[model samples]
Target: MTTYRFSTGETIKHVVLILGALVVLLPFYLMVSTSLKAPQEIETNRGGFLGQQEMMVDGDCVRQGNAEEDCRQRPVVYNYTQAFEKAPLLRYLLNGVIVTVSIFIIQVVVALPCAYALAKLRFRGRSLVFGAVIVCLLIPVHAIALPLYIGLAKAGLTNSYAALIIPWTISAFGIFLMRQFFMTVPDDLIDAARMDGMSEFAIVWRVMLPAAVPALLAFAIFSVVAHWNDYFWPRIVITSSQELFTPPLGLREFKGEMADHAYGPMMATATIIVTPLIVAFLLAQRRFIEGITLSGMK
Candidate 1:
C-alpha cells in the first residue's frame, strides 16, 4: 500500500493558496448572491448564499400601473430579467465580442509572422528588436494612453470599433509569447517545408501555425479576457455612443442613472459579462497550463 503525507511547509502552502483563492472568489460569490436576493435582503445583508428567493414586486411594472400580483416575481427572475431589459446589455455583449475578437485576430496575424521570423530566421538587429519587444512588455498601457487616444482622435477613430481594436492590435506580449513558443519548435520542420518549396509566408501559415495551437490558445485567453473586461479604454473613447460600449462599460447603466442604485441588476449584468470568460478558461485549463509550461522549454 502507498502512504501519502504532506510536510508542514506543503500543508501551509496549500492553506495559503486556498485562502487566496477564496479572497479572489469572494466578490464573484457576493455578486451572484446579491443578484439572487431581494433588494430588502441585500440592504439588510440577511440572505445567505442563493438567498431566500422571496417574491419581489417589479418597481417599473408597478410604476407603469400594472396590477401588483402581475408585477411580482422571484428575486432571481427579476434581477436577471432587468439585467437584459433595463439596458442594451446584449448590444454591449456583442460589442465586447466584436472588439475582443478583432483585436485577437489582428494580434495573431501580426504576432505569428514576427515571432516566426524572430525565432527561426537569423537576421541583423534581431536581438535589438526582441529586446525592444521585451521593453514594450514593461511599459503599461496607461503610460501610453494619452498619446494613443490623441492619435486616434486625430484620425477621427474615437467612438468606433476601430478605436477599441486598433490600439490593441499590435500586442508586444503576444509577439513575445509566440516567439518563445516558436523557439521550442524544431528547425527540421521548417527545413522540411522549405524542401517542399513552401514560401516563407506559406511556412508560417502552414507549418508553424499548426504546431503553435496550444500557445495561440494561451494567448487568446489573455487577449480575450483583457479586452473583454476593459472599461478604461472604452470609457475614454466611447463617450457618446452606447452602441459602441463594451460589457464593462454597460455596467455604468446601473450606476448614477436612477435614484436607487439597482444592485441586483448590476450584479446580474456582471455575472453575465464574466460567465463566458469563466466557461472558456475552465474548458481550456489543461491546454493553457500545457502551453505555458512548454513555451519555456527551449
Candidate 2:
C-alpha cells in the first residue's frame, strides 16, 4: 500500500483559494443585502445581508416607514413597481429568451454535425478541418465584429435579429468543447454500432447523444449565461427598438429614466435579473463539472 501527503506548498495554495473565495463573495453579499433593504438604507449602502429586521417573510409583506423607527417593522414594494412600470421588463425578458434560444438552437444544429464528422469519420483533410475549427477558438469575436457588422449591413440585416443571430449562432467555443467531448466516447462502442450496421447519423442521434447529456447541459449553461448577460452586441446592432431590449440593456434604460436614481429599485432589478442565471447554473453545475472534466481529460 502507498500513502500520499500534500506538501506545505499545497496547504498554502488551499489558503489562497479560500481567501479568493471571500473576495468573490463580498460583492454578491452586498448586492443581495441592498436588494432586501429599505429604500433609504440601500441609498446609503448601510444594510446587512438579510438586512434590518422584520421586512420580509416567505409570504405577505407590509410597507415600512413614515414615523420614528417605523420603517424597520414593515417594507415596501413601491420601488419594485416603479422599476417595472418605468421599463418593459417582460418584453426585455422575452427578447432575451428569443435571442438566446435562437442562438443556442443554431449552435446545436451546426456544432453536432461538425463534431460528429471530426470525431467519428475519416474524410480527406479531416485533421486539417479539425485544426481549422481549433484555430477559430483562438480568434476573438471582436477581431471580426467589424466585418460581421458590415456583412449584416450589406444583407439588410442590421437593426434586426439576423444581425444578432448570424454573428453568434455557431460559437467557436461550442465546437471546440463538443469536439473534445466527442473524442472521449469509447471507440469499442462506436465500432460495435458500426458492426451492427448503424449509420453515422443514426449512431450520433441515438447512441452518442444519450451519452452526451452532461456535455449538452454544460453547453446549455454556458450558452444561456453568455447570451443572457450580453449587452454590447445588442447595443451595436439594435436601433430604435425598446421592445428588443434584453435584461442588461433594460436595466441601463431603467437607470436613465429615474430623475433621482433609486438604489433599491436598481438593486432589486439586478437581483431579479441574476436569480434565473444562478438557479440555472446550480441545476446544471454537477453535470457541467463532470462534462468539463471529461473534456480536459480528452
Candidate 3:
C-alpha cells in the first residue's frame, strides 16, 4: 500500500480551511435545523439537528378556535405552512428576482461601456476618470444612502421599483473589475476589428462584450447576491409599500409580526429567503471562481 503525508504547513492550512468552512456553514445549519424543530424544542434547545419529528399541538390553531385534533401537526409542516400562510412569500421572492435582475442588467449596461472606454480608448483625463472610479469603490453604499433617498423622494420615485434598482445601476466595483479584465485583452484584437471597418461602439459590443463573459458572470453573481440579501436599502426606500418588499424585507417583516412562539416559522422563512443564492453559487461555483481568478490576473 502506498502512503503519503502532507507537510506540517500544509496540515495547518488544511485545519484552518476546515475551521473556516464550518464557521461559514454554521448559520445555514442552524437555520435549517431550527426550521425543522418544534417551537418547544427550539425554545428549550433540546432537539438534535433533525429534531424528533414528533407531532405537536399548535396553540395558535387552538386560540383561533380549532379543535385539538385539527391543531395537531409535525413541526416541519407547521413551520413551512405558517411561513407561506402568514406572509406573501412568493410575491416577495418575485420582487427580489425583479429588483436584483433589473439592478444587474442596468449595472452592466452602464459599467461595460465605461470599463471598455477606460481600458481601450485614449483621450485626455482618462486617468482621472479611472481614478474617480477607484475612489467611488472606496465609498460604501451606506454613506450615500441619505443623499440617494433625498433625491428619490424629491423626484417622487420612493416606494417604486425604480427606487430599488436605479441607485445600484452604477456599480463602481463592476466598472473597476471589468476594466481590469478588459486591460488583459490584446490590442491586436481591437486593431483587427478596426481593420474590418467596425466602429468603436461596434468593437465594444461585438468584440469586447463577448470576450468579457466570464468577468460579467462573476459580477452578476456579486450584484445579485448583494441586492437579493439587501434589507436596509429596501427598507429605507420601500416604506408604505408592502408590495415592493423583497425577500429579506418580507422575512424581516414576518419576524417582527410573529410572536416568540413562531421562531420555527421565522427560521423557515429565512431558509426560503437564503436558499436561492446558496443554490446559485453551488451551480456556478466553478465559473464564478474562474472569473474572479482571470479578472484578477491583470
Best-matching candidate per TM-score: 1
Please identify which of the two predictions, 2 or 3, would achieve the higher TM-score against the true structure.
3
Q: RMSD in angstroms, all models?
A: 3.1, 5.9, 3.2
Q: Which lDDT tens digits does candidate 2 get at residues 1-298?
A: 8886979998999999999999998877776676566665666666556556445321112233244333233433644654576678878888889989999889987888788788878899989988888788778888888888888878888778777778887676777777778899988998899999999888887888788777877787667777898888887777667887788888887777755546656777787788887876688777656544543542
Model 1, span 1-298: residue lDDT tens: 9887879998999999999999999998998898888888888999899888878898889999999999999999998999999888999999988889999999999999999999999999999999999998888898888899999999999999999888898888889988988989999989999999999999999999999987788778767777888888998888788888898888875564744648888889889988897887688887656544643543
Best by lDDT: 3
Q: Could you give candidate 3's per-residue lDDT for residues 1-298 as a string of tens digits?
A: 9777768998999999999999998999999999999988998998999899899998879999999999999999999999988898989999999999999998988998999999999999999999999899888999999999999999999999999998898988889989998999999999999999999999988999999987888788777777888888999999989888999889889977888788899999999998877787788888656644543553
lDDT of 3 at 272: 93
Q: In model 3, where do residues sit more than 4 Å from their true spots?
A: 5-25, 58-71, 286-298
Error of 1 at 222 (Å): 1.6
Backbone collisions counted per model = 0, 1, 0
**Candidate with better lDDT, 1 vs 2:** 1
TM-score of each: 0.87, 0.76, 0.85
Question: What are the lDDT figures for the candidates, one per model?
Answer: 0.87, 0.74, 0.90
The TM-score that candidate 1 achieves is 0.87
Error of 3 at 66 (Å): 5.5
Candidate 2 lDDT score at position 215: 81
